[model samples]
Target: MKIGLYFGTFNPIHIGHLIIANHLAEYSDLDQVWMVVTPHNPHKQKHTLLDDYQRLHMVHLATEEYGKIKPSDIEFKLPQPNYTVNTLVHLKEKFPANEFALIMGEDNINSLHKWKNYEYIIENHDVYVYPRLKSGNIDPQFVNHSKIHWVDAPVIELSSTFIRESIKNKKNIIPMLPAKVWEYVEHNLFYRK
Candidate 1:
């Protein structure tokens, strides 16, 4: 199987995430796209994050109906401050028969040098990159890199932070979230701030 790993906190899974995953699965060489739900990111602030399991559940809910996209909590079992290189190593050991690629946004590539063992990732794995709104054009150097594959995905301006704040302020995010996730969030009151 050809799998692409899309790592994120997914504080709350929204339509933008789903769209990107779907587009990658369809357009890239990947047969499937797994949203590797990060339990804890060493680089991001902790207070704004939802519980790991909670975030995992929301991703599952958002991706339930999609056959090509899967929600993964593999990082939950790995070490804290999870790094992509560590997860990649674990994944390779666990699934030796599958071909895996790293999927990321241009924003990630911009600061990728800061990531632990990022060079190993760039050399060994195929990096599928999607454009991010307001990031200006991707650096020409990266655009011409041999390992990087740029995918043309629709840029949805909505973000989980924006969605959470909207919900906290009593705004409707129905269109911005997956139907099941929106219903689940409404029923459970997960992000009431």
Candidate 2:
């Protein structure tokens, strides 16, 4: 199977994430889009994030109805502070028959060169980039790279941080999240500081 790995913290999976992943699964050649729930990196701020399993559960809730999109907890089992290159290598080993690609925003393309062993990733895997509202100039080298494919998907401007803060401030973030996921968050009283 051809799979596109869409990595995110998914603090609480929301509609924006579903839109992009669904788009890739339906419009692109990828057979399925895996919403790889990223584990919290000890190097980053932890106060804002929910627990790893909590986030993964939300992802599962958001994607449960989508046949082409699935939730993944692969990163949770891998070592922390892990790079994408390492994850790619690990996935290749674990699922040798499947062809794995990357799903990322246009802004990430600008910083792709800085990733560890980025050359290996670019050379081995296809990168499916969707548009972002505030993406800066992309690196000239990747502008026309064969491994990179620019997908004309919707530019979703929503964010998990915005939803979290809205909930904390007593705003209705219901429309921003999937029904089941929003219900889960409400029942658990998450982000309602």
For model 1, the local distance difference test gives 0.86
Segments in model 2 whose C-alpha atoms lie over 4 Å from true places: none
**In candidate 2, residue 157 scores what lDDT?**
94
Specify the highest-TM-score model's number: 2
lDDT of 1 at 16: 89
TM-score per prediction, in order, is 0.93, 0.98
What lDDT would each prediction earn against the true structure?
Answer: 0.86, 0.94
Worst 10 residues of 2 by lDDT: 39-48
Highest lDDT, which number?
Answer: 2
